[model samples]
Target: MSDEEYKKVFSKNLLHFLEINGKNQADLCKYIGVSSATVSDWCNGKKMPRMDKIQSICNWLHIEKSDLLESQSADSASYYLNEDARDMAQFLFENPEYKVLFDASRKVKPEDIQFVKEMIDRMSNQNG
Candidate 1:
């Protein structure tokens, strides 16, 4: 997806998830250890969260990062499918057919890894 499309999706999803959880920007700021302004930026799609903050968000929201990215809502079956992808990757560590692929793909470039991690965080928060 284009960066703008991704941003819009992320922002919408985050707002929805927070609303479902009875949260607001102030609450999220406290939970994620960021300023309310920062949360607002994220919610408004004015800015995105950094990679380090993604884990804190996941922890605060009690969700897998991947679930936030691929599905629009935490309640969707597609959310679980995203989780399943991670599980499958872990499972593939022991599966002969995928072991080589897993090993080779493990070496992700730093920038790509950060981008993906951020996307997952953004997606999950959006769905929340």
Candidate 2:
């Protein structure tokens, strides 16, 4: 990819990660011991973080490095759910009523299994 496209994608991934985790530039700066301007540079695609710093941020967020670097990582992300999601998915598969939902979703693409699991869990909570 061109450098321009790469920068744009990098910033997009950074922004997406922050948004999903309910974090802001200030929070990231404080947590990662970076200046607001540095974070701003990252968010604006003007620069990328150092490898060590990127790893530190990933560790702090309890996420894989790919989560912040890859586009649409959520779509293909597997076994990356938190403990609660893991438990909820398991509970749903074991509950007969919810089992029907999973069986019906057998046609869902493998990449979308995580999305289906979340939706079904939400439905189960509502019905419970």
Candidate 3:
């Protein structure tokens, strides 16, 4: 790919991962030891990170270098119903601790799930 194309793909992937991971440019800037301006440039597709910095970012994000540098395929997984579901799957994959709740929900009835959610919301509201 050309430099511009590469930048576009990388920036898109970076932004998607950051958002799903509940992170921002500032978090990336601190973790990768880059300036806010540099992170902003990368996110805006104005520039690309060097190979070493790319490696650092991949390590920090717990993803592969190809995940950052290459375009992801739409049929990456066949199970998800749509893009949002796939994004949620990716989030669960990255954070396995939360996956247990998702897995448990699969075995629950709709009413039971709603009841549990309401209970949790009530508990949270009380605590807050």
Q: Which candidate number has the best TM-score? A: 3
Give the least accurate 10-residue stretch of model 2, judged by summed lDDT.
101-110
Best by lDDT, which number?
Answer: 3
Residue by residue across 1-128, what tens digits does model 3's lDDT show?
Answer: 89999999999999976765567999999998889999999999999999999998877766678878888888563233355545555555676644443543222344544455567668768999
Model 1: lDDT of residue 1: 81
Model 3 spans with C-alpha error above 4 angstroms: 77-128
Judged by lDDT relative to the true structure, which candidate is superior, 1 or 3? 3
Predicted candidate 1 versus true structure: per-residue lDDT over 92-111, tens digit per residue: 44554443334323223434
* TM-score of each model, paired residue for residue: 0.53, 0.57, 0.62
Candidate 2 lDDT, tens digit per residue, 35-116?
Answer: 9999999999998888899898887666678766666545575443555455545665576566543442222344455566
Better by lDDT, candidate 3 or 2: 3
2 versus 3: better TM-score goes to: 3
User: Which regions of candidate 2 are displaced past 4 Å?
Assistant: 78-128
Pairs that collide in candidate 2 are none
